[model samples]
Target: MSGTVALITGASSGIGEAAALSLASRGASVALVARRADRLAELADRIRGEGGVALVVEADVTSQEAAVAAVRRTVDELGRLDTLVNNAGVMLLGPVVDAPVEEWQRMVSVNVLGLLYTAHAALPHLLAAATNGRRKVADMVNVSSVAGRVARNGSGVYNATKHAVGAFSESLRQEVTGRYVRISLVEPGAVSTELADHNRPEILETIRQRFADVERLEADDVADTIAYIVTRPRHVAVNELLVRPTQQQA
Candidate 1:
């Protein structure tokens, strides 16, 4: 990854932040995108302290304009774009019957639309890199969830968004794999992150109880999976990767 420039959304925390650090450590110039400037700055400082090149771009991926600008800014500042991690997403879980429609809107906006906007903006750059850059191959890793594969009672909207991600990733992969741009989907079963913090109090308690006996995965664990996907040889394209904790069944 020495000559690569990778941009990651939701990069201020969780799997996004971990992936940024991991790629930077492997010698990739990383561009961190997220809504939080302070957190991005903190992560950038950490990466720079380790002698890695890190660029911080503050943007909300839910908006198409912001998403496009983030991608453009990354390419302009980093010289080239080799990898895109569409990791900006939100999970607001609850029953759909009387649930707040705002949660559903938020999930669709970030998980589905956000991914689309970033991919749309970054595809041309990724293709260009694959054609002319050092690696001769580019990667797009979409961070989905196990919820994408399994639809539970309380997470209907979240399930829909992730399922959409899986569909989009596969279709895009088929379209671009021959072009040397690898599109991959990463589904994580259950990770300990701030994702659950956005749930309502009632829903949060239910989730806590459901996973109380299970040892959830760490952010770095999923980050390692992402690193493995992008670092593979050009011929070896990891199309889809599902990571689950040893104790997680679904």
Candidate 2:
């Protein structure tokens, strides 16, 4: 990873932040993308303090223009892109009936549209990297969720969004794998991230009750998975990885 450059969205907190640190420690220059400028700054400071390279790109991925600009900015500043972590997403869980339509809209915008926009913008760069960059391989890691595999009563929309991610990742992988660009999907179960905090109080209570007995995974756990996927040998592509805490049944 010494000459690699990685751009990670939702990089201000949780799994994205951890992944940035993990890759940077391994010698990749990191570009942190998120709407939170303050958090991004702090993270950049930490990376630089540790003798790692870091760039801050503040943008909301939900906007297509912003997503495209984020990708271009990374390439303009970093000179090359070797890995992309599409980690920005929203999960608002609740029963579909009588639910606020806004919740569903938010989830779709962030989870589905944002990922699409970012991936579309980064595809050409990733292809170029795989063709001519130092490693001769490029990686795209889309962070999804267990909801993608199993749909439950209260998590219908969230499930739909994650499932969309899975489908898109697989199709895109098939289209790009021949070019030496690896597209991987990572599904994590019940991680302790801000993903669950956006729900209404009632929904939050239900989530607490559901995962009470389960020791949820930390952000670093999923970040480790992202690092592993991007660092594989050029010919070896870990296409899909599902990580769950031991006590998590579904």
* Candidate 1: tens digits of C-alpha lDDT, residues 41-74: 9999999999999999999988999999999999
Instruction: Give the runs in model 2 whose Cα sits over 4 Å from its true position.
Output: none
Candidate 1, superposed: residue stretches over 4 Å from native: none
Q: List the residue pairs that clash in candidate 1.
A: none
- Tens-place lDDT digits, model 2, residues 1-250: 9989999999999999999999999999999999999999999999999999999999999999999999999999999888999999988888888999998999999999999999999999999999999889999999999988999999999999999999999999999999999999999999998988888999999999999999999999999999889889999999999999999999
lDDT of 1: 0.95
Question: TM-score, each model?
Answer: 0.99, 0.99
Which run of 10 residues does model 1 get worst, by summed lDDT? 94-103
Backbone clash numbers for all candidates listed: 0, 0
Residue 157 Cα positional deviation in candidate 2, in Å, after optimal superposition = 0.6
